[model samples]
Target: MKRNPRKVRWTKAFRKAAGKEMTIDSTIDFEKRRNVPVRYDRDLVQTTIKAMKRVGEIKARRERAFFKNRMAVSRETQRAHRRKIIEGVKAGVKLHEPMSVESPVSSKVQEKIKVTAKRHTALLPGEGRSMGMDID
Candidate 1:
């Protein structure tokens, strides 16, 4: 079956078109194929290898930054959607007003309740003899 490269999800063309890949980066330009043939020198080969590694690192860093920025925007949109849902839920429910402590009914309720402090007794010097033995 014939498929359009730009529309195919797994194609490089699609990724570039969808802004999922870096299209205008200097590191990307370094990876382009050259038609001209060059004489192979040991120093040139070593320098080219180092340059390739550096370019790969730069590309990876830029890709990470791009992904982070994309995810940040996605997170903000998700937060806004959640806030809207919460607001809708709040609108559907009826909230009761808080009761005041100084109200007549509240004062009567408080008067009906009793609060007591508990006291603990400490052992005297003579009571210390039973500390080590268990009694039935």
Candidate 2:
């Protein structure tokens, strides 16, 4: 069985059609096959190699920029969708009472209180030393 190149997801045609690849870039033009025969010169070959490297770099940069732009748009849409869901949830939910204020004792104060209570209990006569050693 034969498969259409345009329909295959991995094919260049499909990627170009789907706007997932650079279709009309100048670097892309450099990649086309030329049937014309040229006399091989050492200088020409070296220049061609340099040009190819430069073109590859330009193409890669352009592709990265394109991908970043596409992902940015997707990220924005995802953020908007998440915000919409949160808003919907907020609208449907009702609190029975007003939200409570923070405790009179701050977190640091609570932690210090707990530590002091533990120290006091540990120092008590009946209770044995933790880990066979006094923790003072």
Off by over 4 Å in 2: 96-136
For residue 64, model 1's alpha carbon misses the true position, in angstroms, by: 0.9
State the C-alpha lDDT per candidate: 0.86, 0.87
Model 1 bad stretches (over 4 Å):
95-136
* lDDT value for model 1: 0.86
Give model 1's clash tally.
0
Candidate 2 residue-wise lDDT, 1-136, digit = tens: 8899999999999999999997888898888899998999999999999999999999999999999999999999999999999999999999688667987677775452434333444444546544445555
- 42: Cα error in model 1, Å: 0.4
In angstroms, the error of model 2 at 65 is 1.2
TM-score, cand. 1 vs. native: 0.66
Error of 1 at 20 (Å): 1.5
**Candidate 1, clashing residue pairs?**
none
Every candidate's CA RMSD: 8.6, 8.6
> Which candidate number maximizes lDDT?
2
